[model samples]
Target: MDLKRRMQECDEFFRLPELAHLVPQRRRAALEQLEQTGGYLQTAEEILIGAKLAWRNHARCVGRKHWRSLKLLDARRVRSARDLAEVCWQHLQMATNGGAIQSMITVGPPRQPDGREFHIINSQLIRYAGYRNGDGTVIGDAANIRLTEFATELGWRGAGTPFDILPLLISTPDEPIQWFDIPPELAREVELEHPEFDWFAELGLRWHALPAVSNMNLEVGGMTYPLAPFNGWYLGAEIGARNLSDTNRYNMLPLIAEMMCLDTGSERNLWRDQALVELNRAVLYSFRRAGVYIVDHHTVAKQFCDHVKREEAEGRACPTDWTWINPPISSGLTPTFHRYYDPPDLDIRPNFVRRDFSGDGGI
Candidate 1:
């Protein structure tokens, strides 16, 4: 987009009563630089506010109620792929926070005038490697097949397990892609077990505690921080209902159904539905047992409602995507499923945008 125009829009946003606490001079200086050189650097305060606003403006997120609590780390001064990878590891350590899971975003160096920038290849900081067998079976999270193949091409190898964590891949303009293994301690995972069913633990299911997304670009003011990885605590359904249960991913429903001795011969039996509920219960039970912070879909939907009300009280509309705001399971039972919201606008600045991973070695 036009850099000058976005800066002007951002300048006006800061002038609003809610953001008046931020010094106006920084924006003036940025505007002056843009006018003279056709580019400008965002000050730390601008970056922080922009990141927070971006989260607030993100339509797909149901966790926007905690936008102000996001911790912003300006890593623009980082000079190499290795340094960037190290910062990412540190981000993991900090965000994990011994299972309390702090909300955070790390803004890397902004794109140059010609659009060259660093980017993390992984969609999320932590994801299981998906190994496709010749028999058309996947050993891990099938959703990550592309990334897993890319990592293999880069000489990174996995232990060939259903829950093997993939290495981090960082790409810079002029450097070869670099990969880093997340320190084992920082790759915290919760082993899933049902409180009522002891046999559930035999499934050997687990999931990472953090959900830091690394592949999305952070568009703030006029600059695009391509390596801005951010995360929030996960809603239980994301892991339980979608990740573990989705057919395209681990596809655990059939196995769970068989183990429970449920009649899955027909769709009318609702075996999949019963298995889904038990899997969700196991996820919630396990996280709580492990002392890792997690929220249920019902609770998050209520929080989303509160967020919408707060945004309305400020005389601003809360742009929302009904499809994403609603949970995958029992969506109709939640408050978010019953109401219409302001239509989402893609042009909103200070927002996160999915990065294109269509290039060679890309995910």
Candidate 2:
């Protein structure tokens, strides 16, 4: 976890405005005392600092320009299944913000001596239920088939649609996975409709307002927090090009092309390309109509370039993942595709690290 280096990072961070009180004494002694007792972020303000740094260090996210504005909720005291469920609901409500999405995170308790921590098994707080039939066909979003199967085994049922929100799955130290159905009022979804095509609304396409990633662990200082669910407003292409059009996901491009009456006989005609544009347009239009905060691919790409320029100006090399930084569609058209980044540092702390979920029978 690079304990010494992170303590030094915290030392410098506390030097920022309104934070000098944290390191009034010798930074070394304060760090040693905190590390010795495993109390890295013992206060709400300390956790807020860590959460902001975590967002800043997220290599795959291109929305670092608002890192300092991330809202952090210190839910470290929440332990039981019921409490976890309520917290998840609250996170959705707060992040959704009634259409004005806000970037936020809820830091759960750190890992225990028994190697267990409170966590949600789903990748996102809002995702479709994937149900697999015996003949290999699937219903709903295929991306979550494994989780959907697991949830079904744990007694969860969905409405059998392309946009059903999966129930919250919570696991404690030594208990079965707890299931909680999120209230419909808390999950604000955008109903996608094309501006030019009236038939598009018949597809009943929809998605949750915010993308709250729930499975990643947060590492700050020397402690490994196994359950830190964080969220940010979506980039439109994430839904149009990847989630809704990926062959293994909703696979909507071909259908949309047919509906648009584009020539599907040959790939040279770029039927898929036309469909992709319409899909992306619909996503942006719907979010805008609902007063939600969603950035288009081109805008976010330019913003990412600006973020890197600012970081480099401050004498820091920006680490990034090219595959994630590049939008799923029209990569060559965006400014972000033209640049190279420093090699990623896999050992960086105060970053979201995926936890291994194998052999977790205790749920």
Candidate 3:
């Protein structure tokens, strides 16, 4: 279906009986008030309807019978306007699931504490932020750093790993920052440097990281902050890279998968799987630190599926693994280094010695 027809279908879907309950009456009332106060009523209607359908679909996918039951939109528990906005976000997620799009752009705060390590991760996040489309066209404009500097000046501490940065870069309270483009080599360097940075290594990756960054950025009221070389190289890389000749590779799906492999181990055991999972967790942490959502694997898979669908519709041969374009480290781009030292495992018990001071008591 065409974009307009699909949108119309989406609109009609919201009016369906099963989905109508998902729309909050208060939201409708608020929109009406805004419209009376000169808000664009038609636009508001489209937004509200879209939000309702999105929430309904999301809830349904998760086997939820009502929108109120979902943590994202429970009115009784919703605390802020941001939380309310997530009700609309459910639509983006649903769209991805339905193969309508490969990715939905979002902006937020870094997932790591505001420190050197966070800055490194932020740098990598900046690199990925440059990811673009085919035909040498940019995706979003370059991410704005002035707002980030402003937030830092006002003392906003960020959280999460690199991937989370996208949201923050895109969603600063001021004007929207355009997405920038980065060269592949520079992107690699940023990834390598991220883990080597200190601030990130100190706090250690934890489950609560992303949420913490998001909460802190929100609390600080969108002030700009001072980001180190992370922001600089990111911007430089975006300016330096040429657009990919092939449109299929533009998604950078393989790059993400490759990074995932790098962060994990190869042993054929639970430890290996666990390590890989940690890598995934770390990536999410990094993205959160960068002030963006870590679009889950399920979302990425859906995107890949969408690409396949599009290729089929266009009567072109769809490559099964565009990820191979970047090539894996094992394929020889990285140099091998042997360990200089291997420490032996040892177990020791502590013993206490009593000191004798017979003459000291008398003194």
Q: Pick the TM-score winner.
A: 1
Per-residue CA lDDT of model 1 for 227-274, tens digit only, reads: 999999989999999999999999999999999999999999999999
lDDT of 3 by residue, 1-363 (tens): 133332333344435454455556634543444334322122333333333333222210211112222222112222233432352244234322322122221222222222211111132232222322367544422242333443344354334232323332222222222222222222222121124334333433222111111111100111111111111001111111211112232333234334444442334434433333344444544544554333443443344345445546756333232232111212132111111111211110000011121211210
Residue 127 of model 1 has an lDDT of: 90
Clashing pairs in 1: none
Candidate 2 per-residue lDDT, tens place, 1-363, comes to: 355665665565556544667657645665776567544545677677777877877788888878888898778988788887888788889888988888899888887634567888888887788887789887889988888878888898887776778888888886777888889998888999988899999989998888999888887655567778889899999999999999999899999999999999999999999999999999999999978889998999998899989989988767888888889889999998997987677765567888777744422
Off by over 4 Å in 3: 1-11, 18-46, 58-66, 69-203, 206-266, 274-363
lDDT of 3 at 268: 45
Model 2 Cα shift for residue 153 (angstroms): 0.9
lDDT of model 3, residue 353: 12
If both were scored by TM-score, which would come out higher, candidate 1 or candidate 3? Answer: 1
| Best-first order by lDDT | 1, 2, 3
Poorest 10 consecutive residues of model 2 by lDDT?
9-18
List of clashing residue pairs for candidate 2: none
**C-alpha lDDT of residue 320 in model 3:** 31
